[model samples]
Target: MKRITLPLTDEQISTLKAGDSVLLSGTMITGRDAAHKRLFELIQNGEKLPVDIKDETIYYVGPAPAKPGYAVGPAGPTSSYRMDKYAPALLDMGLKGMVGKGRRSDEVIDAIVRNHAVYFCAIGGAAALIAKSIKKTEPICYEDLGTESVRRYYVEDFPCIVAIDCEGNNIYMSASDISAPI
Candidate 1:
């Protein structure tokens, strides 16, 4: 139950594993379905993106609007699989981590392993609770994309479980499959 924060580098990320607790800071871009589609198309057509993927963490969250005195609204991890199709390409470009809920494709897992990346899952159904961890947020591009638009967040000890690791380890499956006491 230790805490680790970011601007973490490859060596730091490569060393992480499932079950590790993390508090990520720095720039993590938000992208769900629509944004992912646009990013994929851009990559395919060799178009430039607003931000580089190198050693970046992609959070699978589309937060609600911020209320007064808040930098962002209720923000929490969304389903991970929705972004699966576009994940491999991002990982190939040096995406080192992701934040979301549930499982992902084997291809995505393989991409994580092959590219030395990891996936973290936040507590689902806890948007309000999670929002408190976010110190601030702002849009980067694709503003018309709504909350799915790329943005940056400054978080303070945002909690998460490292569900997948660079070596292909995953925690969610094991957690779900644990036998109940008879």
Candidate 2:
């Protein structure tokens, strides 16, 4: 498996391809549907956002509360489609990567290609296992949203698959083609 460090550069993103297994390390921010809506609204209103997303990877997850000795609980990837509406805008604003489960919209894929970004798929049922990679969690904003609050996570060796690469190649499409009736 390829190991990647966060704040991915253009060279790194360009080298990734759909279906590549990777282990990501370094910092990434977390945001779910609610937080995304807020960010979208801010952008629409021309107001400054609370967080700087430039060159950052946003993971679509609302991690559970931490256990006694842990930084976070069973942190898992959330369905990515829900963020599709806001994704293109975010990508335009310099967001480079996204981590989540499931497929993304066509517009999102186009934006990913246009911006030379990448989308990774985290295993859905491996929340507990995923949580082990996160070394620290710090609240960023939208705290009132509770678990859906935005946060920053410092992680090491976070496992994921390149579901969609910079050039718009998608593993989901390949999978569908393989399963389609001839």
Candidate 1 lDDT (Cα, 0 to 1): 0.83
Candidate 1 TM-score over all chains jointly: 0.91
Over 1-182, each residue of candidate 1 has an lDDT whose tens digit, in order, gives 54656655778777788889877655566778888898888999989877777877788889998888877888888999989999999888888888899998999999998998889999988999988988877777888988888887777788888899888898866444867764
Q: Which candidate number would show the highest TM-score if scored against the true structure?
A: 2
Q: Estimate each model's TM-score.
A: 0.91, 0.95
Please give, for residues 1-182, the per-residue lDDT of candidate 2 as tens digits: 99999989999998999999999999999999999999999999999999999999999998888879988999999999999999999999999999999989999999999999999999997999999999999999999999999999999999999999999999885455676676
lDDT of 1 at 85: 94
Each model's lDDT comes to 0.83, 0.95
Badly placed stretches (over 4 Å) of model 2 are 174-182
* Backbone clash count for every predicted candidate, in the order shown: 0, 0
